[model samples]
Target: MGLFPISVTVVEPGRARTGFRKTAAMRLGSDVGPHGGTPIGGLRAYLANPAAEPPG
Candidate 1:
């Protein structure tokens, strides 16, 4: 048995600056508690142009 078109690559990410944690807290109807993460916007860049070459 073989899986077609299956590729997995590991990525070393820097400090995560997403507000995912904060958003989850709000979903529970709780006050923001010492949130300290910035929006890295890395995904946004890729979404803008999937075929474009990555910036150096």
Candidate 2:
């Protein structure tokens, strides 16, 4: 019999242009201004459909 061990980790960037980040920044009274994240649905959408594109 044999066994194997594996380790995995996941990370999400902060201080970026993401909406979540923007909201936090706004709460802190920072000038988030009018910027956007990855666009559309963000990372989740991109990861789900890496080939997605905005409609024309």
Candidate 3:
């Protein structure tokens, strides 16, 4: 039997003075409730566990 290890690296750019907030605001609109947008934390967690089985 053999074992293999994997390493991952992520490079997120530093926050700059941009119109990102305005863009998100326009896209999200006034809907400030649950399920209004994608779950970023969950997505990152899933990405972290690359060996996990795919969701059914």
Candidate 4:
């Protein structure tokens, strides 16, 4: 088994417009998983931005 490195980033609009509340945005690293990494909570982030390249 190998261990890979992953990162998570969170972005927020910090403002409301058009009578709508702005929600926070989140971003994750490209390399986010091991050979069989199973990120339970991270599923959303991973889905938001799937990795296009393999870890070096």
Task: Quote each prediction's TM-score.
Answer: 0.28, 0.24, 0.32, 0.24
Better of 1 and 2 by TM-score: 1
Tens-digit lDDT track for model 2 on 1-56? Answer: 33867666988754333355445434545322343253533534343442443332
- Candidate number achieving the greatest lDDT relative to the actual structure: 3
Q: List the candidate 4 regions with Cα displacement exceeding 4 Å.
A: 19-56
> Model 1: runs farther than 4 Å from truth?
1-9, 31-56
Query: Candidate 2: worst 10 consecutive residues by lDDT?
Result: 29-38
> So what's the TM-score on candidate 1?
0.28
Candidate 2, residue 41: Cα displacement in angstroms equals: 29
Candidate 4 residue pairs that clash: none
Q: Of models 1 and 3, which has the larger TM-score?
A: 3
Cα lDDT of model 3 by residue, 1-56, tens digit: 33867677999975454454445545655444565356844443344443543433
The total number of steric clashes, by the backbone 3 Å criterion, in model 1 comes to 1
Top candidate, metric TM-score: 3
The per-residue C-alpha lDDT of model 1 at residue 51 equals 55
Q: Residues 1-56, candidate 1, lDDT per residue (tens digit)?
A: 47787879999975544555445434544322343132424333333443543433
